[model samples]
Target: MHFAQRIQALEKNVFADMDRAKSQAISKGKKIIDLSLGSSDLPADPEAIATISASLEDPSTYGYLLHHGTLNFRETVGQWYSNRFGVEVDPQREVLTLIGSQEGTAHLPLALLDPGDFALLLDPGYPSHAGGVYLAGGQIYPMPLLAENDFLPVFEDIPSQVLGQAKLMVLSYPHNPTTATASLSFFQEAVNFCRNHGLVLVHDFPYVDIVFEGMTQPPSILQADTQKSLSIEFFTLSKSYNMGGFRIGYAIGNAEIIQALRQVKAVVDFNQYQGILNGAIAALTGEQTTVKKTLARFQSRRDAFIKALNNIGWQVTPPQATMYVWAKLPQTWENKSVEFSTELVAATGVAVSPGAGFGKQGEGYVRFALVHDPHVLELAVEKIAQFLATRT
Candidate 1:
């Protein structure tokens, strides 16, 4: 059997590796407390589910779904973006529905790059972001993020030669793994940098609604390029509506980028069945109170978990946004992210995502997903405390 060379550049997946170990532990009678993946433990909005259920009886929606059939979903996306960000959008040209934002991220590369063009990506970025680039045969120039910079990549650091070959600059905030949020001003600066370098700006906005109190609402890349002439931002119902399993999402921004992504998508798969689109439209156009309640739940979990970890002697800062708590590993475990994750899960059954899985620059930190309830989180912390106490 033969496989593509791209398959060799990446391993099966580090998160899956942790899952197998966790499963093995559970099989041996360990009480597994999984925090490895970020799939929401919350239920999908009843309204959205109800909307889908009602649509199923209509045989009209059972046919092949194409772009024309998804117009209403696109219009809802445009209105949602306009209301959320105050940026007027033309749904006809600037919106495209995706099976999930992952579909867009993974497919955009094919439209933007001709094997071997460079993509400037976040160093501790979502794994699939890098995988998408590699699958498209593009070279990656990682923009290493650091704590001192508030986890924002330094625009001045990219080399001049690399800029010319770079066709896209991918960024996400409230970011994954690091839980960092970028200000609109920072986004404006990024927009100017990308414009000056002639690069397409792609923003993965899955965590747009996962922000917490006192922090400003993170801006969409579209807001930075208000004319919708140079950038596109992707949104998913997965994080906000607890609809990860539904796999519905959309892209709103530059007409060119939308068209390019649409071209790639059209060749791959048809638009999602209309019932799912109807549910997503309901998610966007219906009452938004659910978002605030969801935020409150995650915030409570974040506070209790951080406080518990601190009391147990792990000095990690509270994250401002996203569902992750990026904690610097203890001195004993620093730089040994995978080992620490494996040993901790094996010993305590409290599974965490290893930072090394993100990138080499992420070696000293471990990411904890705030998915469990406050009390369960506290229990996980206590188990972690016991493991640390005897971890010599």
Candidate 2:
């Protein structure tokens, strides 16, 4: 009946709690409009799917895939990174395939942090970041991402003592649950800071391509550390290529970090299906039209959803990147994010993520994923308006 202490830390996921609430609502015959998770509703690119379909016929791909089997995918990732960011990567040494960037982010702590070491994490960061550090028995020093600072962590504010014990600093942009993008200048500053502090810089870059409004693409962390001296970045096909279910992503940066993560991965499990890698290769190297189309679709949804919320008097800034709208709660619901989210879903059958689910600093906001089509998003907003009317 006894379980490892680590299991206790993993127990309190707000997303899972919301899922149970949603299931109860659905059971009562309430039609559900879920904007909770960021899982894309878009289909994977046909070419990518076709490539995987073709691979399924190859019996050789059915066997367990080892590290060497991932070389082609790694090379593709390297070339993709080079083409996208002007960073030359040694595929053999620098690239490691992952079962989604989540796998890389979650498994990384084991390689970087020993027991009692500190990880400087952004408050309201992606939940898995904290889970990873906890699993590794690492302490977390949350760096609050304040609105005044554009939701980016102010590194200098980190206590000198905490900084001294911190082994790694985790950053993501456009950040999850916040939809804030960091500038190249900020990344440059982070690089210098981490270099000076002798801490590894980890950037979880799932939203790299989900940008909008003719904005410049988000810069790679490697763009700030061209030598990859103290940095590693994780990228996922889930956001850009609509391959979330396929679970294909990669880690690129410090060769030492990649090797350490790979060693951890080897001990845990072998690589994902080789066919999925083929699909990922097709996604990265194939015509990027699907990627562009995906961006356009999300942009339209973002515009429509923001307009609808504004029409209902819930003013929120349109996000420049990522498929989410992070809105501060109204006065009545400001400090009751979990209750507001649960009650809203119960009353209107519209499910969204309570910001408190992400971290303590997320207390007065909610994150709405723009995964549905514009029409459905507008409908969800209409329902939200009705729910708010009742509250008033």
Candidate 3:
């Protein structure tokens, strides 16, 4: 069987290899503490669940959901965004309901790029962002995001030549893997850079509500001045509403980009079943106190994990948002994220994502997902300490 040249460029993933190691460890009867994927263990809000349950008896929801079928969900998302961020979103023209934001993130490149066009991506950004560019036959010029830069890419470092050839720049605030939040000022710079280069700006905003207490909330890239001119931002219900399994998300910003992504969707999938869309609408437009409670729970877990690690003599800063700790590996395991993750699981039954799986620049870290209870997190860290102590 023949495979495309584009598909061949990607190596079999390091994260998948870690997952396999985890399975083997679990099979060995090692009690597994999965800190790998960012899947939420929390329950969906009762109102949203009730909406879905009630819709279960509605036969109309079983049919293929076309573009316009998501109207209520889109309007709810638009209002939610406007209320939360002061970004005006027109449900009619500037909104697209996604099966999940990953779908939007992975497909938008196809709509935006001509073959061989470049995409300026964050190094160690969400892995799906790169996959999207590859599937679009676009070249990825990863802008290295380093610690000194607060894990935000510096537009100045992107080669003028690459920018000249690029069709889009993908960003995520309250970012995945690194769990770093971006400032509005940083987003304004990105917006200006994309405008000057004639590149589309795409922001994946899954963790927008997972922010910690005391830190100012992160801004949407669409909050930048050119957002109305040249940007589209994707939002997911997975993180905030604990609706990951429902696979509901939305894209909002400029009308043109939203239209293009919607058109791309028209070719690929019917919108998700209408019942899920209804449920998403309930999650978005209904009372949202669950959003704050979920944030508080994760914040508590983040504090517990960070304090436990620090008490055990491993210093990792508690992230301001996102359900992850982008921990730099200890000196002994520096530059071997995969090895460290694998060994930690093998010896301690604690699963974590090797940061290198996110990108080459992610080599010195491991991402710890805080999906488990604080007590479980405390135990995970204890096991990690034991594993570290046993290492030479």
Candidate 4:
């Protein structure tokens, strides 16, 4: 049997490899403390769940949901954006519902890139960004996000030739894996760079509300591109509202870009269940107390995990936002992230993501998702300490 070359590009999935190692550990009677993925281990707001439950009672929601059926959700998203960021959003022309932010990030490249075009992506970005470019037969120009630069890409470093062919620039704040947040001024610089290069700026902003205390709330791209010129941002209810399983999110940005993405969406599949949209609407419109509680809980977990890691002699900076801790590998594990992660999990049953899985620059680090309770996270770190001791 034969498969498309595009599928071939996806064969080196880090998560998949980690899953196999986890299974092997489990088979060996190791109790796994998995933290390889960022899926939130929290519950959706009761109001949102109640709204969906109510919608299930209505038979009309069982039918196929087209783009128009998502209007109310889009309007809710637009209003949510306006209320949160002080930026006006037009639901009719500038908002498009997505399965999740991943869907938008992965599919937008198809709408923007032709074969051999270039996409400027963060070196250690969420995998879907590169997958989307590969699926579209587009070239990827990885913009290295260095620690010295606060994990943000340097727009000036992109070569002239790659910039000429680049049609899209993908960014994320309170970014996945890295857990680094970007400021509005940084976003302003990105908007200007994209505008100058005639590139569509795509910001995957799933961790919008997971910001820890004392950190300035990450800005929406639209806040920088106030006129809705060259930017589109994807927001998800997954991280903020603990609605990961709901597959609900939206894109808000330039009208033309939104429409182009909508066209791609149309060809791929109809929208998700209308009930899910209703739940999303409820999540956005209801009292945001759930959001606050979620933030507080994650912050507690972050503090506990960071303290535990540091106690184990694995010093790592406390992330300002997001439910993740991106830690550099110890000297012994440097440049061997995949081997380190695999061996660590196999030996200790504490699974984590190898930084190399994210990209080349990610080679000497590992990402830990704060998906467990403080006690569980500390236990995982204790196991890690024992494992590291063996190497010494």
Top of the candidates by lDDT: 2
Q: Superpose all Cα atoms of candidate 2 onto the true structure and report the RMSD in Å to 1 decimal.
A: 0.8
Tens-place lDDT digits, model 2, residues 126-186? 9899999999999999999889989999888989898888999999999998999999999
List model 3 lDDT by residue over 1-392, tens digit each.
Answer: 88778886565675678789999998888888999989999999778889989999999888888887778887887888788888777899998889899999999998999899999898898888998888899999988989998998888888888877889988998888898898898888888888888988888899988888898988887679534899888888999899999898888888988888888988888888888888888888878888988998999999999999999889998899999999998999989888898888988899999989998889999999999999999999999988888895
Question: Measured by TM-score, how close is model 1 to the native structure?
Answer: 0.98
In angstroms, give how far residue 73 of model 4 lies from its true place.
0.8
Which candidate would rank higher by TM-score, 1 or 3?
1
How many steric overlaps are in each model, in order?
A: 0, 0, 0, 0
Alpha-carbon runs more than 4 Å astray in model 2: none
Alpha-carbon lDDT, every model: 0.90, 0.94, 0.88, 0.92
Candidate 2 TM-score versus the reference? 0.99
Distance from true location, Cα of 196 in model 4, Å: 1.2
- CA deviation > 4 Å runs, candidate 3: none
Model 3 C-alpha RMSD vs. true structure (Å) is 1.3
Q: Is candidate 2 or candidate 3 better by lDDT?
A: 2
Candidate 3 clashing pairs, residues 3+ apart or interchain: none
TM for every model, in the order presented, reads: 0.98, 0.99, 0.97, 0.99
